[model samples]
Target: MALSPEDKEEYDEQRFAWIGADTVLATKDSDQIDKHLRIIQARVRTKSATAHRAFAISGRAGLGKSTTALTLGKKHERQRRKLLGDGPEVTPVVYAVVPPGATPKMLMRAFATWLDMQVPQRLDAPSITDQVVRVLAQQKTTLVILDEVHNLRTTRSAGAEAASQLKVFTERVDAAFVYCGIDLLTSDLFTGDIGKQVRARTKMYALEPYALGSARDREEWLELVLGMEDLLPLANHPEGSLEDEAAYLYHRTGGSIGSLRGLLGDAAIEAILTGKERVDRALMDDIILDEEAVRHAQESTAPSPTHSRAKKTG
Candidate 1:
């Protein structure tokens, strides 16, 4: 049986494995990160209640850009919660991974649930916006993290309507959002109305493929890439160290942290299931070349790729 969309997402989170993409993103993509952080710092420091702070974060696929934003959101809120309190004064950090072909109502529904607010039964575009804005005002959220933003584009209106919705949502609210997407020209090459709006509010970060770097940086990055515990099974291999695998792993994932985690995790399990306890370089190679790995993965559990989008149930 095909998994529900919600079930597919849950399964993906549980099975994820590699670290190549995240390592480079956290360590190598310094310039991009600096800019993203700067924007966040600016927003949080705004003194005026009426002044709004908003910006966009765009990176190439396979970079840890989204993860980085999510991390920032998570950490910032944690610190804020400690400094403030657990009550309504705390700035709620909300996250949403926008879906491909998603309408504005769909996006709004996601934000509503993210904030633990009521999801309206009829999620029309206007209602979605009204309800979400009301909830954000009620919860006092200061930061919103939108991951996989490239997926937010839909076949309808070529994303014009959706873009307008986001623009309206971002403009009137005091809250800030860190929007994550693929590299600027390659993935988003933002066109027409949507392009202009994204360009206006976003601080673009172009995350490129990973390259070999300093020894300490590479080691730390690799450990972060594949968690120490995650790499324990590979210790018995004669031909490998986790650090050695990092470079090749980076190439396979094209520097996308999310994909890197999923790819590596998938390879490790495949090796163990095939009677090989050690995840040597070769097994990683098989997974590296296997484009099918990703497809097979989504196929195993996710809903059949839905070209026909479903409207959210009330």
Candidate 2:
């Protein structure tokens, strides 16, 4: 059955949004997310006065650390509400991004804004911290997930200040924190006095890129590709094509799930805009740097090492 023009246009728009920066898709990394969720829930469930320990999700740009943390926050929010049942709406998890080059004051303001509360003008960092803490308590927040935590590494003093603020939060609030960013454990944010305190308390979890070195890794990578295939709104199915292009896709993306998604997403967009019906090798050729083309170019152009060696011998 043919889709009406209106329906087709809407479907295409929805497909585009599927791969947008804000949209979170569950990948193989979701298993790790499940573990984090369980940890946070345990922290919430435990009644002991034992000091709370935080955890981090660390990875390079494109490993979906931010998405995973944000998604976990949302999931926690829903679970919190459901558990409350007849109780008033309580936000269990608060998600915030550490602004680039943000100071303690700026970080407080960001937190205030994320909570939908106004930051009073001309307030000191201590006052802002108090207000933010009160609000989180009022909202019954159990966890705080800070994304782009590496931004705290702007400088030694800045990193220390940020780490101190976080440490204070852990000391003052009942909430456990989750920090997500790149190489945060090795950053200045984990170095120095206050940083050392935070590093001592928070467990580190690393999210590595998908590897194609083993059969298990390859299967996981292919599962990711198939998951993305289910998102594309192409008239002709593109499921098998991704499996067929597995080697090339892995090579182009270096097994980074984000890069793989971007390559396939951009190709899907091109296919939609050009009315191509579906993604194919030829379509991907135009969108991604074709590996075959690169191989042919390299094979054709360079002076032969064998010939050079023969000439040298002669």
Candidate 3:
């Protein structure tokens, strides 16, 4: 039976709401991060007093480093709740982001804010740090995730202080530390003596963008596209709409999951609004993506000068 126009409009609104929310797809990189997080959690639990090892996930922007870390942290929090029972104060995961141009006090305040602790403005950096450390210890927070850690530059005075303070947090609190940031290994965060200390303790996991240079790569890319397509809410969409344009999609997105999400999400919304109820090459071509993805796609597709010369000779 055909529904009323009003009913169809209401249903479309619900679908839009669903499409707006982020959908986390489990990938090989996230799986590795999860395994490492579990190991760190176990070690921290067994040896509470010892300063345990930490890990960092470094990558270019739009490679889903923050998303991967946050998702793992949330998963760990859920597991802890199951084991320890969900108490108001049983926070097994504390997630915070390093503020831009963050000072030591500012960084501590970020943690304090996440833990819902209100520190008076009169308090000094040491006082704020002490308070945050105390609460983290008391709450038995087992995982501390600091995203955008690349912002804590060791070259500048304030950033250096914040980086040192972070080290202190790892020592003072008995939680497994995980840092996520853009291009951290080459950044000033790992350059000095302090950097040596950090580098020695934390393992680095670099998340590279997906490529289409191999058969396996193509297979994985297709699987990812299929997974994303499965989540679309279009009623009249074909099953393999996205898969049919796999190569074109890769050229458009440069295999960055975040960029792909942006492109598909916008296209999906456009499809619903325009009553197309399906995504295809034409619709995606009309959707503009981020500057970086577009630049990358252009670079990837452009013929090399060597190829051009060879074509002329031939």
Candidates in order, TM-scores: namely: 0.68, 0.81, 0.88
Writing each residue's lDDT as its tens digit, candidate 3 over 1-314 gives 18699998898888888877757576658788888878877887775555689989999998888778877877888888999889987889998999999999999999999999989999988899899989987887888989999888788999998888888778877788999899988877877888888888888999998888999999888988888888888867899878778888888888888888888888999998888878888998899999889888877767787676322210
Please, what are the lDDT tens digits per residue for candidate 1 over residues 1-314?
27787985564444343322233224355445656666765766566644354555665554567666765666668776876688864556888877777677777777777766776576587777887777777767777787777765533574557667877887666577777777554444255555765665566566554444677656655755655325434324443355566765655554445566666666656754564646656776666434533443334334455655543311
RMSD of candidates 1 onward, in order: 11.4, 5.8, 3.6
TM-score of 1: 0.68
Q: Give the distance in Å from residue 269's predicted Cα in candidate 2 to where it truly belongs.
A: 1.7
Residue runs of model 1 more than 4 Å from their true location after superposition:
1-27, 30-35, 44-53, 86-91, 152-158, 185-189, 213-240, 247-259, 271-278, 286-314
The global C-alpha lDDT for each of the candidates, from Candidate 1 onward, is 0.60, 0.74, 0.84
Arrange candidates, best lDDT first: 3, 2, 1
Query: Ranking by TM-score, best first?
Result: 3, 2, 1
Off by over 4 Å in 3: 1-22, 48-50, 307-314
Error of 3 at 131 (Å): 2.6
Which one wins by TM-score: 2 or 3?
Answer: 3
